[model samples]
Target: MKEARPWLRPDRAASGGDIWKKMKTGAGGACGEDEMSGEKTILVAGTWDTKDDELSYLSDVIRGQGGQVLSMDVSVLGDPKLPTDVSKHEVAEAAGSSIQAAIDSGDENTAMQIMGAGSARLALDLWREGRIHGVIVLGGTMGTDLALDLCGALPLGVPKYVVSTVAFSPLLPPDRIPADVQMILWAGGLYGLNDICKASLSQAAGAVLGASRAVEAPTFMRPMIGMTSFGKTVLRYMVTLKPELERRGFDVAVFHATGMGGRAFESLAGDGAFAAVMDFAPQEVGNHLFGGLSAGEGRMTHAGRAGIPQMIAPGCYDLVDFVGWQGVPAPLRGRECHAHNRLLTSAMLAAEERRAVARSICEKLAGAAAPVAFFLPTAGCNEWDRAGGELHDAAGLSAFCEEMRSRSPVNVDVLELPCHINDVAFTDAVLARFDRWVAEGVISH
Candidate 1:
């Protein structure tokens, strides 16, 4: 007979069972009472069958900090030493499958995918029902995979923490990561607990609980206008447009047109979080099309899919931004380049590449369910490409503008303004169209 691991034994007091029971029964200081008084309820999620000891420790720490835990077991094959608030059977069934079906599949990846779908659904349901305030998931690679899904299911401003052996590893792609997720490396915590692992688990528990308490979720009191722009140095329209739009009874959210910022904007827009969009800084479309610093796929399509009216522009269409540290890409070498910082570099596109970017932008806007308007500033699209600016290119700018005019979909209303993108005249043109749209009920206040 093999000897049982100390933490694996059901009756082991040192494995946090005693603390869990105390928390449940109100025997510990303010644990059960705090839970009833609406203390933060964090969904402690992981393969509870294999990581029960570690998950319990995390729950214990949360309870000790006057927080409540809703443990969710996502294991496929084995039973947890203790019952979880959300069992593996419940998880499997949530995805319209059974635990038996998952096991019968006999492939670990397939089994985990079923669990991942179920876990994401349950997490969203729990959030909607006001049962969970935040979530912290534990895993190696498998748990991390489910963690991303679970976190992605919840809206922004909810506390999401992932403690994984591969936290911050290249295995995790930026597009899959939610904008506000917190990750801690599970050092020395692959199989079981020790002092180092406990240090990580305890800190993660406190951090999630603290975040849940401190976070102020979005109120959505005023109608929101989602706008995209780079910094004031390159794109100055937002500086004038945001306040002006707010004066017209709308809140403006300006998303930086860098990679991750555009991802967050798209995610929110896809969820119908915006009343309308000013997608002026759409350089990410070109970035994705040309294999530069990308904001992943589906860049300029989310608002349209959600039936949100869009005011599009070709700001910064003449430049392709790549990671500065990686050196200039071979295809773009010897182009007029600007090193913005240690982390970002921009290369001016050739006339044909600018034309290609223009076509890509038109293609994305062609499918808008609601009204679509494209603003083309013929003098220049970005401040850096103005007449005396470093990136000035008359022929390239002409190519882009001509392509936009020729390729724009019939559904799109193209406004060709004969001013630089930074000019007050350009801003006035956008506002004029926006005001007309509001009057015509194309956009509701």
Candidate 2:
């Protein structure tokens, strides 16, 4: 493993009063030790040399909007306490070692990584001290990178805003902030405090203040029930399992059954994040078994050991996902396939491949406790596998099921539903079995 960053190993750094307090009493007495109370405090962090004029005007606009503003200059090129705002010294003092570590690392990536950790540490400490409810950062590319790191570190519901010159493209690539947070884009560099700066700052302040006032009552305290789904399989879960589970007072958290989606759900289950696993679509494992493109990592089936009430289903197990017709590997170039959409295609898994998938799934479920159940829809498991579609392989599915039943340990109960996976009757059967298990306390509600 790479050597941990200095800021990440803060126990080795120093232990005194908080960074702000130490900065107030040390070197320059730059900022007072007064804590922000009642109203939310917005921490605006940036390079003073580049953003001083912008920061000043933005701070004024925020205060005018009845929000407290605390400006911290991460770059220590000048006095942090300039003409306005809170202690610049405290910000520099806390971030100085981190900035120096980044410079000394020689590798720009490693440097940025350490700096990002430093910013997160600062935000966390401020939040603990009740001095920060939200954070707004202004930057160029480097600044945006550093600020986004801090934004992600804050709580999921906290107000985080970033104004960046590159935010329009590079900074906002996939998404720099979570869906709940706000990010503003500015095309030009921060030359001085202008109208855009004022607007962004004011909006950030109001957001943080509003967020501070909203009471975050616990949404639900019921034991969490995890479900894996795809666009097709999700309908069965949404229309049936979700309402039924909610009626039984179990909080449902659905994870899309894509590769990452399955991995994330498994990880959360392993981390004691859920009380039960209703993994309806084991597509990742199917892909891995079928030599398709959606294969999961080796650890796809880790939920059993986590001791959760696991109920597994092979939703979409009949079809293997592939990108466009041109993107399918040469060996499978002539296989039975269908164009599901412009960017995606589906293919039939061979009998041998289906048997392999069954074996892998059975291997995982074999070790599950008595409460565990594996349901196999004998008619069909997907829209393409029922009535009229290229992927309806009853012979292949039967052969696979027979092999699995013969090979699997008897501890796992395998139920064969006569209805197709998408049918309302099949969904009803699934709910009845699951609810009975939960009601009997075989699986925790």
Candidate 3:
């Protein structure tokens, strides 16, 4: 139905590869005149054919907040109830497919995938050109996927939001989610403008516009330092470390070593988002190595490999996470267990596994092209690993230490301090080593 388009990038569809491709050019038009009016242009994205009234209501709510709305129709079904700035056909075509092709294939899932990919590409193009300040979409499961894809296309700062019936399901894969993208459970967002539906739509629209107005892309004079740690039970050193880091003129961003948090940390580091990294409590590493859902495959690798000055610690290395008592796997059933809460538990790791984890960590860090520092506190790695505590595993931890020291890369400055991970001496040792690296010009203060 149109001229040939050039491809810029190919993205995976639910079907497979090449089902969705971003175009180099299409209807690359601005959303509206709001770009220069000091008014935010909010992209109201959804299947306008099915949820017309709901999408329109959101647009009205956004406009009421003094923001302009760009209705990007991603519908693949019948005619749209309302006209959109970017039409469904445009979105489909932009994704290296067409709505008619999807319709001919007679697959709702495939059609949604094509439109979602196209819509994301279009939204990103518009965003890159400052045509839209934020995006808001409302839907059930299919709509949620499309919304998530669009949100993923934008970076950390843009106001991307999804009001979805399935907000907490597949969205749990934090690696696929953009770090700052927000979501609201779609209690009544899929249907007409009733009292219940209107309340949620209004909130979503307002939240996005407010986010757009309030969020400024972070600019910094001092280099930002990214750190990873768990909760208080495992973050005793971080409390002293982070403030000292800030006092020395480095802005530090601490990532809780939850599965998703580590996912974000990895993404941010890979993108050179942080000038340096202090990956202290890499509990996710053990989680990944032991089939725990919260750990990521590349937890400790990105920061160091980014050629940034990184200080790596095997913090909380003695335990692997299992949620609740019932979640303890059969293999770890009798192991020393610490109940952090009704929802979270830590199980003591075995010596063989600890040694394997340490070797793997060294292998990962071996690719570092910048200043690398590895420190191990020989006493223990976390609260439950210290004296007379539950989940103690000094034998396993020492095994890790021994393996790490043997495999430590020549470029890395490795240290084994004779103190518990939470002890003041351990913190002091970490600071002193970092200070030395800075003085040696391997890093800047």
Best by TM-score: 1
Question: Which residue runs of candidate 2 sit more than 4 Å off their true CA positions?
Answer: 1-38, 43-65, 70-100, 125-131, 136-155, 159-218, 232-234, 258-271, 284-307, 320-372, 395-413, 424-429, 432-445
- Model 2 earns a TM-score of 0.66
Candidate 2 lDDT over 4-95, as tens digits, reads 12211122222111222222233221111243235667787777656777766656666777777777665533444464343434443454
* Candidate 1 accuracy as lDDT: 0.84
> Every model's Cα RMSD, please?
10.9, 9.2, 7.1
Better of 1 and 2 by lDDT: 1
lDDT of 1 by residue, 1-445 (tens): 0111111122322211122232233321211233334688999999988999999999999999999999999999999998999999999999889899999999998889889888988887787667888999999999998888878877667799999999999899777788789999999999999999999999999999999888876555566789999998889999899999999988899998888889888877766667789999899988887778788878998788767889998889888899999998998898899998999999888999888998888888888778899989989998889999899999999998889889999989998899999999999999999899879867766
Which candidate, 1 or 2, has the higher TM-score? 1
Evaluated against the true structure, the overall lDDT of model 3 is 0.76
Candidate with better TM-score, 1 vs 3:
1
Candidate 1's TM-score reads: 0.90
**Model 3 misplaced regions, further than 4 Å:** 1-37, 100-108, 170-172, 188-193, 325-327, 409-411, 439-441
Cα lDDT, all candidates: 0.84, 0.63, 0.76
Model 3 per-residue lDDT tens digits across residues 1-445: 1111112112211111111111112222232324544888899988888888888888888888899998988888776765789998899999999888989978888888888779878887888678888899888988887777888777667788998877777645666677888888777555566788677788889999998888765443455788888878566877998899889877788887868888888876765556678888787887888866464677777766556678888888777887784688876788877777898887878999898788778888888777788888888887777778676766777788889888887887888888887889988988897788667766654
Cand. 2 Cα-lDDT: 0.63
The 10-residue segment of model 2 with minimum total lDDT is: 1-10
Q: Report the lDDT of model 2 for residue 172.
A: 52
